[model samples]
Target: MTRVCRLVAAALAITVPAGALVAKPAPKRAVAKVDWTRTFGTTSAGGYVVGNPKAKVQVIEYGSLTCPHCRHFAATAVKPLLANYVRTGKASYEFRTFVLNGIDLAATLVARCNGPAHFFPMADQLYATQPTWSGKVEKLSQADQDKLNALPQPQMMVSIAKTTGLLPIAASHGIPTAKAQQCLTSQAQADGLMQMIKGGEELGVQGTPTIFVNGKKVPAFDWASLEPFLKEAGS
Candidate 1:
């Protein structure tokens, strides 16, 4: 019976250290992946920052809300910048509002009225809706324009924001009418925005969409030109 059992076991190819003939291979380790795109922070200067805070490559842009060039940059770069670079935890992006005029000031005020969480999303929407709002501004009557120019900065900003059809955009993006009113009417907030313009000038930013990579200004202003620098920076 023992002889027969030994032969059967051999034939069946079943054996064990305890029960098995072959050892199983160890499982591969899982790498933890993080999507830094959804991570938003505020800089000491109040600019909205996105991505891995400690990433090697830091990107900064001094941009105007009303600038066509800045709108184009938002249209082209926001997605890729957040997804390819920021998502991988390789880089960070910061956008500082540089107000260029009354309309720009009003837009910036309203865009920031909600909170840091809504800032970027609102900025994306604002850029997407730029043409519609700007066109409305151009269609303003001469007398109305003169009246706007005559008013003080705060009230003028409120008027421009309303007349340019920008207030509705703000409302749609989570800013209540009362909040938008407060943003446009607040002297303190308006001064804070003016400080942004001053800060941009101090950085020698002469135009809209001025970008800095790793603390150095890149000569290129658009996304296509900026992508190569980001790649070279390990992004």
Candidate 2:
């Protein structure tokens, strides 16, 4: 890990053998630890996190769902990031939404359907299918766009979700169309997402897919540039 690693080093957790922390008696053979990759939590900054909470290395990403750079990074980085780093319990990964616009917010709400455990999978699928739907709304006539922008919360979300195909993508992830709409209309959730944008601003984030390793901003914009940094950080 880098110098920034020291900042969080104070959070170190004592290590014990697998299942040692539980009440069950020690087994004849070692019981494997629960997969850190499947574990999920929320960071104080409102980012959805996965992996060992006390991992030595920390990887945080702030990005806009509509940003092509973010999509490209997600397309390549996600699998290996989970497989090699987060899953190993050496690092944790967190994604803070950098809301760019109404469409991005709608997409995020739709992707977040079913709650935190389903968030990553829905987001992953959204990125994978981005090329298919991300551009549709952009092609709207100026008048149509004006109308969409003038609409209120749930209506705007409904229009954007339908136009961008977010509804179907959500459906594919087991979020029924009605459930997706409910997620879209959630005023509290939308406000929380907006707060995440403000949080990103406090961190001096200026663009999509910003990477922070152990609290240090790194110049990694994609998987190729990011992998080395994570590896150097003990990934």
Candidate 3:
């Protein structure tokens, strides 16, 4: 028998009565306390901020909804950053939408529709499912593609959102189909996203997943490069 089994058997033999049935020990429950210091809000620049409002280091990430690199970074780096730096009040993180196309704009609209409380979570969900939805658009028929392109920008975005499965993804995130469609068609939301894209350009953002620390752009884009800047700024 294995060492663990032997230990269990020894304990059971010592604790049980001669004629009694052996009872299994209960599973240990996880008791880790959740950290609630992380907070969220919309920025004047039309971005979403998550973490301590008064943190010493400020980290801003310019990301696109349909960008694969952005999706990878969100999946791999964001949670650790939130846990180690943001939760510890060493840094504040902000994510600004840098719409790369009509589909990106549509996705951002649905993500922002649920307000600050749900913004980050919705964005995370969109990034996580980016491949599945984007793949659907890649496989569309030529005639259907042309039809989508023929519509006006707003209508085209709504059509793309529905066709590419983005609407369903949004619906799964507690945004109803009607609400998602309305957000996709909202000119105000579209313009706001556009303004943020322009703002990113003005800040010299040349690509998705651009990192800024304390109002200064980081030379490299990955989390490995960005973390040191955050530590230096926080120090």
Candidate 4:
């Protein structure tokens, strides 16, 4: 079996809810759900934009693909927020990735593997399962980091892609052939990522899953704390 299938099976062994059968690979559907034009950017490191173009509050989330905190936010908070706010034109959302390590870069490449249409869905899936893959490095010793760091870029990407439940065949089909590889090695994308990191720094965002509403930081993770800020912005 491929590495991806192995990682996915390992994850399912743990998280497959009681009495529920393992979920099969979803159907290969047309990329119909996304508003492609809105996702466009002048540079290579473009992100998906969802919600009302005219919404008063613009929320930009700086996430790392390998970050467990980001996964929790995606699985536990983002879905509801998107349904309640983004879909209703009350808010707009943008996801920017911070590639602090090779694993993060690999994961980012995979998330963009399926283009804009599958970007959000793939991102949600990766974050939901992040805990399983983000193994204990401190306990394992520095050798573990070396092993991860030693992998060739292509191999590293394939490994990260595996952890996200994507088969090699699926990646081949979904990812733009040249773009997939290009997105990883591109200097332009790297610069864009740096800018995002610096932008977050300037905004006083100190951690993963940090949220900003109308240029003001929401100091907590829970939506209840953030809702008040939204109300204030919307008003």
Q: Which wins on lDDT, candidate 2 or candidate 4?
A: 2
| Model 2 spans with C-alpha error above 4 angstroms | 1-33
Clashing pairs in 2: none
Q: In candidate 4, which residue pairs get closer than 3 Å at backbone N, Cα or C atoms, i.e. clash?
A: 4-162
The top-ranked prediction according to TM-score is 1
Among all candidates shown, the one with the greatest lDDT: 2
Candidate 2 structure quality by residue, lDDT tens digits, 14-74: 4668976688766798768667889998878888999999998899999878888998888
Q: Order of candidates by TM-score, top first? A: 1, 2, 3, 4
Candidate 4 TM-score to native: 0.66
- Give the clash count for model 3: 0
Better of 1 and 2 by lDDT: 2
lDDT value, residue 224 of candidate 1: 86
Off by over 4 Å in 1: 1-32
Q: What is the per-residue lDDT of model 3 for residues 37-115, given as tens digits with 9 covering 90 to 100?
A: 4478888998999877778888899998899988878876777788788887778889999888777877788888887
What lDDT would candidate 4 get against the real structure?
Answer: 0.64
Whole-model lDDT values for every prediction: 0.84, 0.86, 0.82, 0.64
Q: Give the per-residue lDDT digits (tens) of candidate 1, residues 56-77.
A: 9999999988899898888787
RMSD versus native structure for model 3: 11.4
